[model samples]
Structure formats: structure tokens, C-alpha cells
Target: MAIAKTSPSIKYSFPPFVPDGARLIILGTLPGEESLRLQQYYAHPRNHFWPLIAALAGKRMPSSFAGRVALLQGNRWALWDVLEGAERIGSSDAAIRNPTPNAFGKFFSKYPDITSVAFNGQKAHDLFRRYVIKPGIVANDRLTAIDLPSSSPLHTIPFEEKLAVWHDRLAPYLPPKPQNRRAK
Candidate 1:
């Protein structure tokens, strides 16, 4: 009798939070286990994603799923992962294999206004460039890619540093900050 070996299966990512009139798209590699289990992006309490985003946008961290979505949509920024599916272990990008990139063709067709893509980390940027940009599928003369520090607790870089870069890099595409209107 021979023993059988099984290969690891690829896990698929959730639907993107792309909205119409979006100018910037923030791309991550893939959601971690906690995020997948919670059916939310960056659901881990230790993850700095929400805090960084809120600080950059000059808004409070969203405490609810709907609030998070609203924050991104309101800023005309989109959120998605570069890889739609991959065989990864323990939520580490280094463990990822057999990656399948997201459908950028359809996504770009729907959100033609998107001017730039900001990658959350090197893995996301590399994957997108190798799978989509280099292939000429999503890359174009008008569209640019920016690499930002990962907000994952795994990344170890300070949140303030990441937030500064994110704010500066994305400022041009972001809408003007809202002002508090007061009436007598």
C-alpha cells in the first residue's frame, strides 16, 4: 500500500470595496485568518490598517463594517487585494504560493476613474506588477503604482511612519478635508 499526499488548497479573497468615482485604490496581498473568519478586511485587533487609514483621512477609526466601507467610499478610495486566491499558511505572505491575481480588467472597466494604485506592502506591489502590470492587463500610461508600508502588525514599522507616507502619497488623489460648519 502507498501513502497519499495532498496539496494545500488556495483560499479565495472577498469581494473588493471599489466604488464608482474612485481615484485611488489601496491594495493588500490578502486578508489574514482573522479577517477571513470575520468576513472583514483587517479584522485583527492588532492590525494597524484601520487606525492608519483613519489618521490619514483625519477621521475617527470606523468601529463597524458599514462605517469602514463608508469611510473608504466617502474618500473616493477603493480597497482590494492584489491576489484573489493563493495557497498560504498562517496568514504570511511569505507562505503564499500558486497565486491568482484579481480581475483587474473588469474592475478597471467599471472604475475607469481610478488614477493610481497604492500597494499596502512590497508583496502586494510585486504580485500586482508581475501578474497584472507587466502583462499590460491593468498597467497603462496614466495609471501609476505606489508602494506603502504594510499596516499589518507583522510589519513592525511604526504606524506614524506608515501613516505619514500614506498621507503624502495619497493626498493628491484625496478630496479636500471637510470643514466643520457652525451656525449661530
Candidate 2:
């Protein structure tokens, strides 16, 4: 896919933060308007991203931005988007254009500890194939990329179903929480 030319009316920026010491990097397309306005990742109220993450971790929903960041960091999860910047009319992934993709290689190089990478949805997976992954370029010992279900209300699947899929895909990476351990 060819990159679209940047538009004068469009303004975009990368997520303001990322988790340190992340073992897995999770990428998505550009943040929705709510996220941008809030200056936080997945801030849209209807978005299932945060709730799904909480379900997977078996924790109560985080009530604040700092709590959400802590939850991700505590789980060794890193968050960022595949597009460094893009022109778009709204939150729709299909509306993205002139995408200046993020330098994922740089992150992988710097955080050699990241062993697995997963995309938040089809848009990210497709973009990765078009821009990065399909190039046959590997960083820090050949990271594997997995396509995960979109944790968005736009997806028709029920919340429980989404949780099940995510739980299975993420199981290998998440260690058993203390609550799940049995007394020996």
C-alpha cells in the first residue's frame, strides 16, 4: 500500500507514553478522537480495550490514567500505534491516510527484551504487513507478530467472546496471578 500525502488540516501525534521493561509490544492504529483529546491510550468510553485488558488480568477496571498505565506496566505490556502520524477524518481505521508509520525497529532494538508482538486489530496487522513485517526484516532475534481481535465496540462479537479469544492468545505470556495459584 502506498502512503498518502500528509494533509494540512490533519494533526496527529504518537501516544505520549509507553511501558518500560515490556515483554510484549501491542500496537494499534492511531488513537480515536477521545484518546487524543484525553491524551491517553484507548480513552474512548465505548472502547473495549481497557475493559478487555482488565478482564484478562482478572483485575478491577482502572479508574485513572495512571492506574491504567500501571496495569499495563505491571503486566509487562507495552502500548503504541503502528502509525506515527496519519491523516484521518475521525476515529475510523479506514479513514487513516498519509501514514508516517512508527519506527518499531528502533523500539525493538532498544528493548531487546521484547520477545512477542501483537496487533490490536486487523488494521494494525495489515499495516504491519504493508509497511514493516512483510519486509522480512527482523529485529532483536526475530520477533513474532500475532493478530488480535479488535477491542472496539465496532466489533459485533460479545464481550465475553472477545475476552475468551484474548485470554487464549495472551495466556502464554501472562504469568499466573497470586490469586490463581493454589496452596501446595
Candidate 3:
């Protein structure tokens, strides 16, 4: 008898961390094994997501899951993946198969405030365009989508370079810094 070699199917665990005031959403292909095990998006230590986001917010990288969520929500950013579930070999997005995309129609309707979406990688952008955009779901003028480099550590580009691109692209969507008024 021959043994079958194939990746296992996994369902997304954490619901989209979409704060009420979220103006921008960061979308990934799917949570990797480390993220799934830790029950947090971008849980892999080597992943550049936390560092890049922290730099954008002018804060240190958070060491805890709650802190990370605070960073996202505080900045009016949301996090979610393109797929609801998929069969993947390891954490590689290239190995994904039988992908079931999340309900973007319902999600967009529920979160009407989400004006912009940034894809964390090419695969995410491809999946979203093929599954959601091609179907005429995200045709509204209020929403804009941008494709960004993957932060999975698999991409060897310098962190500073990636940060610069993210900062420049995302700056307009992020909330303005609060002005501190001094007592007259």
C-alpha cells in the first residue's frame, strides 16, 4: 500500500478583528500553522507584520496578542484572511488548494466603514480579485484595494524598504494624530 502525501485542510479560527471605526483592512491569504497554533494573526516571530505596523504607528512592537489587537484597533485597522478554509501544505500559500473564500458580500455590507483594503501578499490579492472582484461584489466606489509585499519572512526584502512602502501607502487612510491642547 502506498501512503498519500497531501496537506491537511484547516478552517480559520479567529474572526475578523474589525473594529467599529476601521477604515482600512489588512488581508492575508490564510493564517499559517504558527498563527493558527497561537490563535493570533501574524504570530510567527520572524514575520515582519508586527514590526512594520508598529513603526507605522510610531510605537514599539507589541509582545502580547492583546497588545497587537490594541495596536490594530487603536489605529483603525482591521485584520482578516481571504480564505475561510483551505488545504495547504505547511504555511506556503502557493500550496493552497480547495480554497473556500469568506463571505465578502456580507462582510462588506456589515462593515460599511471599511473604505480600503491592503493585500498582504500576491496570493491574497489574486484570490480576492478572482473570487470577490470578478463576481462584481466589490464594485462600490467607496472601497479601494492595494497589493503589498508579503511579510511572511519568505520574502527577503529589507524591512526598512517594506515599512516605507506600507507607511506611504497607508498614511492617508490612518487616523490623524490627536493634537494636545495646552491650557492658556
Candidate 4:
């Protein structure tokens, strides 16, 4: 289905942390309260998204929102959400209701170079399946969905365990760091 332009009454913005010539697109369901408030992705202090990414990228942790945005963009990674708008009571993913999911097909059509799609958690994946994947907008071969552990503190998994799983799944997608390169 085509994504219609959001109505002016809708109070939302697509905070895409995208990079040019990105081969991968990482999707989430929607911005949590902190993200919306800060006008940035993964704004919650307890969210492991940035820290894990920094570790995987082998860079010092980004100190500012612009720094984080630059890191993702520099790596040729794109970030956006599946939901354009939703009735959310608080930041909990479980609290989302009547979601107006974004038009992913349109986005993909605009950027055919995106070779892989990653979901931040199961909610985004499920939304994609119900709205886009099952509808045949996205062919299974064209994209694969990897459900990473939720970065939310609510998940209660230890940080190390989370890092292990995320590191394993995300390592292949990360652009190689200079330190990892060897002289020929």
C-alpha cells in the first residue's frame, strides 16, 4: 500500500538517522517519549542502542546528538521507524495503539540500493510483516529481518549478555574500523 502524506494535524516527524548510499536500513516501531522529547534517536539513558553501536564501531562514545547522527551516517547506515504515528501512552512499546505505520515500500522504492533491513525489536518486525512484508511490498529475498534484543531497560537482560548477542548479529553490518585494518 502506498503511504499517504501525513495530515497536518498529525504531530510527528520522521527522525531518520539515515546515510547516503546506505546499504542497510534499521527500523523501529516509533520514537519513545525520550526520543521525541530530545528529537533524536535512542535518547533514553538506559537504551543500549548507541553504546552497543559505539562498541561495535570501535569508536569513543558519541557525546552529542549530532555526533551520533554523524556516526550512523558515516557508516552508511539508515535509521527510521515503521510507524508514522500511534496512540502511545508512555514510552512502552506495549503501550502503542492504533498505529499508523509508515510507507516503507515508498521509502525502499526511493532507495533501491538498500540491500538489508534490520528491526530494532519484534514490534517493528511484526508491523513490517503485517503491513509491508505479507502484503508483498517487500520480497523476502530482497530483505532479511534480524530481531535484535530490545535496548530498553525493561528487557532486564544483563548488559554483557545483550552486548554478546548484539555484537554477534551486528558485527557483519558494521563498516570496518581503521584499527582492524592491517598493513599489506
For each candidate, what is the lDDT? 0.86, 0.79, 0.86, 0.78
Judged by whole-model lDDT over C-alpha atoms, candidate 2 comes out at 0.79
lDDT of 1 by residue, 11-98 (tens): 7798988777888999999888899899999898999888877776678987998887887887888999998999977788898999
lDDT of 3 by residue, 30-61 (tens): 89989998888999999999988888888888
Greater TM-score among 1 and 4 belongs to 1
What are the TM-scores, per candidate, against the unseen true structure?
Answer: 0.89, 0.86, 0.91, 0.86
Candidate 2 local Cα displacement, residue 148, angstroms? 1.1
Q: On a 0 to 100 scale, what is the lDDT of residue 167 in model 4?
A: 77
Instruction: Write the residue-wise lDDT of candidate 4 on 1-184 in tens digits.
Output: 9987533223244756567879888787788778888888889998888887777667788999888777787778899888888876678778777777687777888888987887887888888888777788778788867778777777788878878887787677888765675789
Q: What lDDT is obtained when candidate 1 is compared to the true structure?
A: 0.86
Lowest summed lDDT window (length 10), candidate 4: 6-15
TM-score (C-alpha, index-matched) for candidate 1: 0.89
Runs of candidate 4 exceeding 4 Å displacement: 1-13, 179-184
Clash totals for all candidate models: 0, 0, 0, 0
TM-score of 4: 0.86
What residue pairs are clashing in model 1? none
